[model samples]
Target chain A: MRTSKTTRATKAFEKALATRPTGRCVLRLYVAGATDRSRQALLRVRKLCETELNGEYELEVIDVYQQPILARNGQIIATPTLVREYPRPMRRFIGNLSRTAGLIVGLDLETKGKGAV
Target chain B: MKNNGPQSATPTARLPKCPTGIRGLDEITSGGLPRGRPTLVCGGAGCGKTLFAVEFLVRGAVQFGEPGVFMSFEETDAELKSNVASLGFDLAGLVRRNKIVLDHVHIERSEIQETGEYDLEGLFVRLNHAIDSIGARRVVLDTLEALFAGLPNEAILRAELRRLFRWLKDKGVTAVITAERGREQLTRHGLEEYVSDCVIVLDHRVNDQIATRHLRVVKYRGALHGTNEFPFLIGEEGLSVLPITSLGLNHKVSNARISTGIPRLDAMLGGRGFFRGSSILLTGTPGTGKTSVAAYFAQAAARRGDRVLFFSFEESPNQIIRNMRSIGLRLEPLVQRGCLRFHAARPTLCGLEMHLATMFREIAAFQPAVVIVDPITSLLAAGADFETKGMVTRLIDFLKGGQVTSLFTSLTQSGHALQQSEIAMSSLMDSWLLLQDFDGNGERNRVLYVLKARGMAHSNQVREFLISNRGIDLVDAYIGPSGVLTGASRVAQAAREKAETLTSQQEAARRKRELERKRATLEQQIAGMRSEYKTEEAELRRTDEQVGTRTRVLTAERTELARLRQADAIRAASRTPGKPKPKSKR
Candidate 1:
């Protein structure tokens, strides 16, 4: 039931991904507390920003318990919510963003649409 | 008899309940929204979604003494404060008192671009911050559906919304999330799916140019709730949902009596008036002085030191007060004394359920012993007949349960009395006062009759209702030949009777005078005769005495000669009557 497809939606996504400049990245990472998942989420988001933006990036790591207002403003439901706030269309990923391939696909960093991207 | 959607009353025993404290809302939901679980409130624009959310928080903070956090995504804190100001909720003051926390989450579609990946973690954090700051037990996310518009991420938004509900449940804070109704679904963004505890649909529709608002609980995961589309209103008191519940017949019966304000009407109602806590329906046509009668009742209740709440659908408070003055009912003093309260609104101003809800709210607040709804038929113009009946049934139940006397007036079309028998609530009414306008003899006459009075014997005779400067009066209707007479005819009938009485009285006086004259004549004649008889008797006595003296002198002279004659006469008499000559007789 979930595998139904619309090619227009796919084309739209690829177009949005290709049009992005990706020069200066803005990231807000939300973590719950001083736990393993929090530390892992923070470390992974920081590493991705460093490598991807090449030092031209602003990263905001928010501890949900300490600054819950910011997290709530971001509509954060789960801790370790990485929000890429720059570009034309904002995208969100759950978990710590530890899987680089999954995170890459979610962020549209490397478009894999053959007919479009 | 209309089917009001599907009725699903699944017992939700597992989920703890959160009472919203809004009038009639808790009753419909059985206990309230599922406790600590997110309940989705989806509605069209301007259908009281925001007000309902705000009221939930405010009521939580004020009534339940539970601190709440109102996280609005569309309106700012200032806007919200001003919006709810009419409801008497001081949002800022509540915030200062640490009873509530207001957080505005504005989402703009043009503010962001997609770089890598993002989540609505900020919203969660802010809501958490507000909750923690006040130790809130209730949370409201006002229109989180803005995210569906501000951000082009339906997949992620839907995913995050589910997580939010789960998180709210985990935090043990009851949350209310409002969303706009979708074109084909309850919520535009499918927020109903995420909030499994409850999904309430608020509908605002304009049928025949009359706008009405309705609310329905489409699904409650674990609770029993009314399935009908209840009409809700956002007024000075806030959101009140009118639950169209049946009268369970569990009202506490009272034997006390209260007056109908009109002495004669009271007389018609078994002397003292209606039974205490009884529902009285005063039905009449236009301009039959229904309001005046109701005002009289309010005056009576107020005069008796009982608080009275008068709801005038046809007239404003000032208008009623002024109009009642013509009938000598001065309600302004009672209002000033806080014994009489007036709630006036147009029948078209709100739906039937909304009217019921507003009445319930006012009744709860004023705590009046008597509630008078002048022209309750006006509420029929707002909704279908069945809906109004359901609302009225619930209202009667509520008033009866509280042992509060309630009076409802309805306007019919004509004097036929049976023309607008549309309500058919005579069974529920403890007493029904039917007023009629007798249009005959080139005049309109008002008449009142006790159509029905349950639990008491009431007069079956229709009386001509007389409205004077003093107050309302009911004169016994003349049932002579004509069906019923009133106004000029009644007065003329009374005058005619008075004239006949006067003529009869005059004739009686003349007969008495004639008899007295005859008796005086007879007495004079008798007196004259008595005088004559007395004179004759005196004359006879004098003559007899003179004769006796003459006879005695003659007898002595003739004694010697009579001796010889007397002896012969005695011997002849003895021979003739020998048997009579016995010893004693001799």
Candidate 2:
């Protein structure tokens, strides 16, 4: 069942890549204090990137505790802040990664049913 | 709530004004009272009429180095000094230094007779002489009511009082004439209606058992003054009026965010912490660790190279720092580095508005990123509920607009669970941390719950916390069959469990005793039955032996008789008579 799904997903990915192959996006997540929510947000963001952007996107995870100055400079007030630094407009979304749809829209990603290519 | 006059530019001329030198009072009256103008201060008894007049003259002479004259109709200089000694004002020192001249004018009302119309020329000479002796610029008449009493008719006395005020005004000297307030008018004889350059009304009223001293500028000509009833506190430092309504709004603001100390707390407040210019209210009951939380936030901000100011109304600065140290918060280093400042003053030192003004002035000078007012409720004792609420609202607005992260602590009364004051201040705050004493499982536990934080995602669950030598630590909330335990109920539950265990032990002992008694009774009965059976057996054995012996002896005698004499007769009779007697009897 897993092999069948991968093959089917590869087919769809190839079809989409064939149409729009140059528009790649990079995402970075800023988190303060290693809490369960932070870990969940990280995992969710990674999983969503893998499923949606696949290998075309670059992701960087910044732990604010290890870099307090960066957190201050970025004006990050809460933990699990996801920032689309590489993308245009440089939008930032703060929350647990549970809200995948909201993050997708906030990061300016193409939705599954609308605005593809 | 009413504005007294049209907004007009104050004529900054030589209108004799005496500087009260009482912090906000001087600022509110536009450089004190018309320098040498005789201004009447009328109020009821114990309404700080005497203290207000005394502080005006004493502060002018002592603080401003202006010589003053104080003439009293009620108390002597010694009595006045003793009364104000607790407030740290040295009235006698000023008198000895030739800066103050005190005169007690003793007048008997019955001895005076108004034979002819006369002005207060003698009183004027005495005042002028006292002023000349010390080169005085300020004069305080403790009670003009005594002078009124000395005159026979009210009509003549009222005219003379007006002339006296005019005379002092012409002398180019600032005079404070105190008069007892009448039930209907501003003064006992309506003297304020006559001389109307400036009329200040002092009121002492008890609302819901709280005594508050308020001063209202009834009329101040050529000066823009606050027309509201300003709360004033009379202490060792004389009279300090709390001016809450007069502050400029054009202050500089910063857009930076500051840390709240606890990393998790900071995370909840949007990884960076609170907005640089925001007021946070940490409200809870006693022993809920509100002070500890505030100290943690201050220390955190100070560590990050940001200045922090802490104003405590309950504890002294030393006591607050010492208590924080015991709870693992070190503020001494921050103080040494000039990044942290701790100011502690009694809430009763001044009225609520004055306390707010003092804090505003201090914060303005220090320009701290974070400021903490631990327990703002204690300072509200000097004003009414409406005044306190207004002051807090204005303070929140001021702090927020200044871009300073302000934290306030409030003690919630038992029955008043709803956060009425905090609710009023909620919209002005960027973050709200609600600390509470949760009673659960018969134990009182201190729990902190974030009610709301604008522009940041925060934990909604209430977390149990402990304050120790290291600092504040967030512990997991107790989850059990019973809810959280707190206060006296927790102790009573433990005692009850202990009593139950003791009762169970006693019950077991009682059962063991009952069983032992039953066993002993059974043993005694068994022993008695064994002895009776043994006796019966012995008796039975003896009877059997006797029967056997009789049988043997009879058999032997029968044998002998049978052999000796016709033998057959005894033997046959012994043997056959048994069968024959049976047949014959039948």
Give the clash total for candidate 2. Answer: 34
Q: What is the lDDT of candidate 2?
A: 0.73
Q: Which stretches in model 1 have alpha-carbon errors above 4 Å? A: A1-117, B1-14, B61-139, B150-164, B243-247, B261-263, B313-366, B378-384, B439-445, B468-473, B481-586
Best by TM-score: 1
Give the C-alpha miss distance for residue A3 in model 2, angstroms: 99
Task: Write candidate 2's Cα lDDT for B19-42 as tens digits.
Answer: 788755776787788766778899
Model 2 chain B worst lDDT run, 10 consecutive residues: B110-119
What tens-digit string does per-residue lDDT give for candidate 1 at B4-111? 323232332445788898776888888788888888999999898888888888888888888998888788889989878978878889988999988876665444
Worst 10 residues of 1 chain B by lDDT: B3-12
| Candidate 2's TM-score | 0.54
lDDT of 1 by residue, A3-108 (tens): 4466777878899766767467677777777778678778877776666555777888878778766665676654566777885367666565556666666666
Model 2, docking class: incorrect
